[model samples]
Target: MNTLNLADGYKVDHRNQYPEGTELVYSNWTPRKSRIPGVDKVTFFGLQYFIKKYLQEDFDRNFFNKPKQEVVAEYRRRINAYLGPDAITFEHVEALHDLGYLPVEIKALPEGTRVPLRTAMFTIKNTLPQFFWVTNFLETILSCVIWMPCTSATISLEYRKILNQYAIETGGDMEFVPFQGHDFSFRGMAGLEAAMMSGAGHLLNFTGTDTIPAIDFLEEYYNADATKEMIGASVPATEHSVMCMGTELDEIETFKRLINETYPTGIVSIVSDTWDFWKVITEYVPQLKEQILVRDGKVVIRPDSGDPIKIICGDPEAEVGTPEYKGAVECLYETFGGTISETGYKLLDQHIGLIYGDSITLERCQQICENLKQKGFASTNVVFGIGSFTYQYVTRDTFGFAMKATYGEVNGQGREIFKDPKTDDGTKKSARGLLGIYKDANGNLEMKDRADYETEAGGELKTVYKDGQLLVEMSLAEIRDLQAQEVAMDLTQEESI
Candidate 1:
């Protein structure tokens, strides 16, 4: 009885054409043979396809952009150039055709699955036994597509958690937590594959980005939309500028220049600090303030150094510092008296706005509201101008990830697979199996694999090339969305294994 199994059922057809089993294609990897098949002896066609579609796409963009015929020719030339002209003789091609396993596709793990330690998120197997060794060269692409998205997505999710807490304390009322994280770690990623993964990180959970290149990758390889709303550009906001009358000619001129440049259009605001803030407000503000109004007659002056939460807690915008602030306070008391003027009252109400910028932590955010109650600062008057401590550096390198080879079938036996005992740190685990992504009850994920050279499950990644006529073309976003959704589901409990 013939025991050879191929993607297009070899029975009754190619049995007369080719030899079976070991005489077929295999990777040229030969270690002291363990329980399952070890990598050994690859064929030409598989190597050619891998170089055309994946290796070149990542290593050289020119490799990716060139026409398919050019790519195949280049690949063949390189193979012959390196391995010798006699290496890929016609007999090799004929032998591969006889095997009846020419193409296959890996369904793969989705992009943001919160993958735990040690799992093969991808599976690769034969499309035609004759081409099995020819196709094995695609292992590199599997790694590129799978882990890059996995690691980046995990980091982005963590960033959101920290920002979420900070936003709540700072008086942000939102229906849901929004992502404003970047794949900042992209700078440290391994290579082109990692760069693409960095972009995927944003898709799983993030809002804006400074990495513009990643945006393009998402559109090309994964399929995601580039929208202003996704990047925090849709929020309409207003701003203003003001100065203390007595700092210097330049400071006053600078403020006046800015004021003249911006009033009667958008929101108008001024900072009355520099020197004797109270005196400037009691003197210069009452008249020019009206001239500076917008359609809603609202203006915003920024608060810094002093406790910002108090500004929104319902208090006046006074000079807040050391002995210097006291001088301004006293000058105002002498110049305008202690009966807080209608100007201060109006500034604290709807017509005016107070904006603050400083070491605004979640703790400080709470204080801003608390002090507002103590100082009588209007909550609506205060608009936070948060910087440094809150916007950047949310998540560190915490998520641990690793890829493990799980299943395969070879010879007459079928079983799960794993790497050789550790001699190399983390870099030595190579795949050897038929793999698949699984979701158990409670939405957890698991990778199922048959050992190298073992019987595989029915579903395999399909290569869509029939008669060498490229039959399928998938856009990046379509794949990205698919990846994004896959990651949204649960994987195995990290602690469970």
Candidate 2:
């Protein structure tokens, strides 16, 4: 595909629409507001991936490395067909191709930093005077590529915080927290690329994921080595089809074969709601209890279709002593009993566990943990499969993300520009002039708008990409460590409150 075509249709004619003497355009990407409750910050991520994949590799492969005439003619052909033959000329395209590099500088907060609302997470400007339009010309693709990872990472951090609080409260193993929130979002994502990006974002806070390609993406772009370190991992697991193939009447046989013949060892997750979730939990599981307990590892039961909170923590309205009333955790406790935590919460036997993945949200997650604590069970007894319901049901506006040019220069004169629409709420009002981000005395990141050149050049933002080359690189390990530190700090603050 022609990399130039990977933009909004209206952006094609933008090169000629700028003022006659426009020499430089300085723009910043900021999250103006957050619509998510209790989430006042956004996670800064995917900037490095954008620079490496789109800015450097894509341009070099499809435009700069190709023959100038071929790419130029292709660009002209597409524009002519879309907007008539004389809609725009191809001079700028040919000139950029001849220049052999994208002339833009991108300075960004460190990947994995939790940037506060209204702060500029990154700033972009043209390096050369003639390529000022390139600053915002790249906006369409940059916004498309960057938003999902940031959104997913932010949402993932929320999940992490919830799990961490419950784990500490319930005396659960803190190391198990990373494996508690597994990414089951790949199959339900928009496409392969979206899955990889969102899945990689989820991996920032968790080590358990079913998104295999996400590991490949991190390795290729973020300097991750699967052999040397754990990127993302999943245990042997089964779906509805596997159980159905073994025949419903002989579901017990399927369990026997799996626990006795197939795996007989490490952790294995089997989807239990294929036929009768209650029967599997109350009857089939008890019939196989001896086998399950005798095995060398844990047997994780997955309930895929139900109200996740009620299903895992018991349906309160049901009969008092029934399987549906007791839920998966209590039902398992009846068969394979385990010890209690230091905090007095019931710890499920090491040989059995439960995971619920259907349509999970942060609210539901918190509710489940709250209910479990009330029922004397540790919150760690159930692992959560964070599927598309949490990762895909979001947009760029989830954090009110936008990229607007605040400062520009024309004919050697600097201009500080902004917009405050009277009809709309103040959320759309953008910052004026150059922007810089700094930490105040409270140690919270804050943005300073209308700053002079020197102030804009300093503070938390670092130059990650410049003139078509990557200036700073962060490995997956480094990003994960940084995110862990932020999460720890957040947990500390929450406790005080």
Candidate 3:
């Protein structure tokens, strides 16, 4: 791992080897439109993390020089393994080794700002015209870094808006909204990096997370110190395996021990659907009510399987009087009767709550909030564990993210280039010419094409990366502030509508 070879890192054919007179290829990536309508703005994030993690290290010449021959041999060996011994024709990657650094410049919107669809978050191009191929060569890494974090940020913002609306209508404390949508996706993401990156995005709006690497990621790249700042955190929680160790016959004892002996002074979550979810709610909870009520902490009940909406907020159509009829909230209400607030919202007893972590979608979140309101319950009575279903089940095309070279220079001439494939409809048509992002009359981020960077005084994009150095760094607090501004704007607009 000490010697780095990128021969198979990208599509071998995409090495930018040939395209007549195409000494440079310029491209721009935009989320043409959201797959989910009304998702018009996306949160710009993860650029700092990606640049610090992937681009600023092990990639350039100085680092590669230490193991120069080994790096060259690996590249040659891998390429030859794929294309045959003599098909290797690119000077054994020595050109890159001798060059000693990447020749690239990157500009981007500050992390945490809201960008309108089709606006570029960041643009990359080769600083040395001869290394123009490096622009697209970096795409393999850029796409992986950009799309997922942005997508996760966008999704978390949408959740924030939903929770904010519910907080307003249900008289729940808005200050507590950030911790409502917790991250439980560490075990479910594509990899550790994926979890860390997406989890960082989640922390932009909330401080609750189970992804531990995210805290480390924020500390490393975003100037966040857990000892000094309230970074992502979570409480002790149990899974089926931990509960099943004592057997289902002793399940009630497990709950008693969790409340009385373990984690008695802070929030602790216990998954309650191991053998029988309804029995735990109707039978087991009553047995532990004294311990739960006097523990001076919260006990959050987790329902791992079942339709989340019906499980959290009861099915109005189900048989009304049977033990099988009541849901978690209703059952909890029966055991410890709660008082309604002035806004007519049911405030669950301080010691008990509900959480549903499985198969939660945006629509499910909306429905759950609305259903709880209809039942005179505050939306804050429950917390949501947004799992990989929200973070992992996405792709670049989820928002039509595509990076294409729009302008390049060659032979002392600058050319504006774009792709308008007529073979299909217009989803693939890209922007033409050099681009600039500026705020318009309404202070919304907008894109301008065929623009000069030096004279564009109104442009908001700034140089963040040049050559091998990261020129601009962002802290998590700065990102959170940007997101808060955008959320305030969105809420204002929503009220007018």
TM-score of every prediction relative to native: 0.47, 0.99, 0.93
The CA lDDT of each predicted structure is 0.39, 0.92, 0.81
Instruction: Residues 1-497, candidate 3: write the lDDT tens digits.
Output: 42233323445545445454556666665787788757888888888887877776647433455566777666668767877886645652566667877778888888898888878887888787666677877776677678888899999999998998898888787877888999988898999889988998889998888888999989999999999889887888999999999799999999988888888798899999998999899899988888888888889999999889988888778899754456678789889777776688987888998888898888899999998898888898889999899989888888888778888776657788877889957888878778888887999878888887563334777888888789999888889999988888888998999
Best by TM-score: 2
Question: Each model's number of backbone clashes?
Answer: 57, 0, 6
Q: Could you tell which candidate, 1 or 2, scores higher by lDDT?
A: 2
Model 1, 156-275: lDDT tens digits are 443443444333333332222342232333444455555544554554454444455666555554334566224221122222233433244445444445445645345554554555
Candidate 3 residue spans exceeding 4 A from truth: 1-24, 60-63, 323-326, 453-458
Compare candidates 2 and 3 on TM-score and give the better one. Answer: 2
Local error of candidate 3 at 274, Å? 1.0
Residue 481 Cα positional deviation in candidate 3, in Å, after optimal superposition: 1.2
Query: What range of 10 consecutive residues in model 1 has the weakest lDDT sum?
Result: 36-45
Best-first order by TM-score: 2, 3, 1
Could you tell me which 10 consecutive residues in candidate 3 have the lowest summed lDDT? 1-10
Which residue segments of model 2 deviate by more than 4 Å? none
- Writing each residue's lDDT as its tens digit, candidate 2 over 1-497 gives 78999888988877688888999999999998998998998999999899989998899998899999999888889889999998888888988998999999998888999998888999999999998889998999999999999999999999999999999999898999999999999999999999999999999999999999999999999999999999999999998889999999999899889888899999999999998999999889999999989889999999999788778989989999988888889999989999899999999999999998899999999999999999999999999999999999999999999999999999999999999999999999999999888889988898899999898888888888888889899999999998899889988887899
Order of models, best lDDT first: 2, 3, 1
Residue-level lDDT for 248 in candidate 1 = 46
